[model samples]
Target: MSEKRDMSRSRKLFITDKLMRLLLVGAASTSVLVVCLIFLFLFREAGPFALNPGLGKLLDSQWIPVSFQEEHFGVGPLLAGSALVTALAMLVTVPISVLVSIYIAEIAHPTEREFLKPFIEILASIPSVVLGFFGLLVVAPLIKTTFGLSTGLTALTGALLLSLMAIPTIISLSEDALVSVPYALKNASLALGASHLQTIFRVTLPAALPGIVAAVMLGIGRVIGETMAVLMVTGNSAILTASPLSSVRTMTATIAAEMGEVPFGSVHYQALFWIGIILLVITFFLNIIAQRVLKKYGMMK
Candidate 1:
């Protein structure tokens, strides 16, 4: 009688486990389905323009779509602007974020870590529009006066504001990554006569490199997708230039600023959809690269 009861219990547990596994699989599949639907919608909407616009014209630098007689839909300027702003933002964010992470993870006392962690979380919670307003009202004027530029609305202004927004993400994730390094490895380094800073540089940081790369990639993704702050302070000029002082517009800002004005089914509307496709492609690749790095480094299975 006891053996029969035990067998029945085992069977019931197995059934329950199988059901849970099926439920989890369904949940995972739903996310993939949603992403596929979004890509389908974008391609469907942009198909007309993508087919009609000759490749050479589409790649041109000019982007005047509102002109009645001559409407151009070149994406070169928007892509350049996005690249410039994102690159500058990363330059400002990466070093400061890594240093802050190192201090918080390896150097800060428990009490200080508690305070700093919450402060960084609060910084991340602040609304993007509010930051944009701050940029326009405060940072913009400072830049204009300090640089003696005609206007504060330039790529540098946008990059600075985007960096402010991205710092919290980079710092928090990077600190977590640094903290995850094994205490054993650190102790071993110290036993070998390495100083605390040396252990962090040579032992902990190497083990945590994958996570740091992932953090930076996530920060770049965040900055690339940001719209309100960029639109508010980037001067909205669709001009191709590498100089940080030059006014520029990004792909995200283009969609946000002009989507409402463009007529439905028009070529301009279709072009905006094409831009969405481009953004989706960029984000997808970034995530894939980050995941590959994590997998290669044995940080993720």
Candidate 2:
């Protein structure tokens, strides 16, 4: 009787485990399906412009989609603007985030780490719109006054705000990666008479390099996708310029600022979808690269 009872209990547990596994698989599969569906929908809507966009139209500096004379769908300015802002944001964010991460992971006391971690997380939780408001009201004026510019709204303004948003993500992920470095490696470095700083730069950082790369890539993704803040502060200009101080319009800002006014199924509307496709592709690549780095580091299977 006892043997039969144990066997029955084991069988029930096995069935429960199998059910849970199936549920998990289903959830993952659903997520993948949803992503593919989104790609299909975007491509379907943007197909007309995306498939046969004229050479000059796509590469033109102007982006006047509402003009009565000629509706241009050039994305050169938008792409350039996105790239400029993202580059500046990454420049400001990556180094500071990595340094802060190293300090939190290796140098800070446990109490300091505890306080800092939550504070960084809180920064990450702040809404983008609020940051946009802050940028418009505060940072914009400061930049104008300090730089002696005619207006405060420029790619630099957007980059500054986006950097603020990207920093928390970079710091948190990078700190985790640094923390995950094996203690044995650190100990061995110390046994070889390496100083703490030396050990960190030579051994710990190298071990955590993959995670750091992932962190930077994810931060780039955050900066690239930001809309409200960039729209509010970038002056919404579609000018093609390499200067960070110039007013610019990012792809995200373009979509946010114009999507509502565009008639549904219009060429302008479809052009917006094309922009979405571009953004989706950029973000997808960033995620793929980050995942590859993580997998290489054994952080993912």
Candidate 3:
């Protein structure tokens, strides 16, 4: 009787553990389902825009959705503008953020690093609207004056603000990567007559390459998806141009700016959904690339 009772108790514990695991898996699967549902709905609505031949005009520099009367459905300009702004922001952000991360992780005194880290994280906690407001009031005017921009809002203005926003995330993630570098490896590099900087570049960074890549990818995703601040500062012109000083519109801005006014089932409304699809695709690719890079570099281990 005693042995039978013990076995029953053991089976109950096993069942409980399996049940918990099943619940966790179900939760994750449900979350993925929700995401897939969103993608499906976006595409369903965007089908008209995708099917329209006027998509060519939407890519054109001039976006007078009303002037032509016949209607136009161009997305190329918005897509290109968003890409350019995000690229510029990444250019400005990645180096500064990585360097800062290195300083905090590998060089700074513990007390000072601890004190500063939270402040950096606080930047991420700030709402997007506040950042947009800051850009409108402060950065936009500064850009107008310093660069002679006709309008305070331009691609450069948005890029600058977005770069600032990207910094906290990049710094936080890169610092974690730097911290994860094996101490023995650092010591070995130093023992071989390598200076701290050389050791960092040669040994520590390479080992943490995956995490750094992940950090940059995440930053790109943030910049590409950012709506409020970019909408406020990117001039929202929906015109494609090479000049950073000129006004531009990003995919996110187009949806945010136009969706409300566009009548339901209208071509323009469908086009906005297409823009969402594009944004989703861009983000998905970035994440997949980051994952592949991490795996290739053995960082996942």
Q: Model 3 RMSD to the real structure? A: 2.9
**Of candidates 3 and 1, the better by lDDT:** 1
Candidate 3: what lDDT? 0.87
lDDT of 2 at 286: 99
Clash pairs, candidate 3, are 58-74, 59-74
lDDT of 2 by residue, 1-301 (tens): 9999999999999999999999999998998999999999998887776556543466666788988798888888899999999999999999899999999999999999889899988888899999999999999999999999999999999999999999999998888898899899999999999999999999999899999999899999989999999999999999889998989999999999999998888788888898898899999999999999999879763
Candidate 1 Cα outliers beyond 4 Å, as residue runs? 1-27
- Residues 1-301 of candidate 3: C-alpha lDDT, one tens digit per residue: 9999999999999999999999999998997899989988988887766566545645655555655556655777888899889999998999999989998998899999989899998899899889999999999999999987678899999999899899999999888888888899999999999999999888998888789989899899989999999999888887769889999998898889888898899877776787788889999999888878877866664
| lDDT per residue as tens, model 1, 34-102 | 999999989888888756765456776689988868888888899999999999999999999999999
Q: Compared to the true structure, candidate 1 yields what TM-score?
A: 0.90
- The CA lDDT at 261 in model 2 is 97
Model 2: ten consecutive residues of lowest lDDT: 50-59
| Pairs that clash in candidate 2 | none
Model 1: how far residue 82 lies from native, Å: 0.5
- The runs of at least 3 residues in candidate 2 whose Cα sits more than 4 Å from the true structure, single-residue gaps closed, are 1-25, 50-56
| The 10-residue segment with the lowest total lDDT in model 1 | 50-59
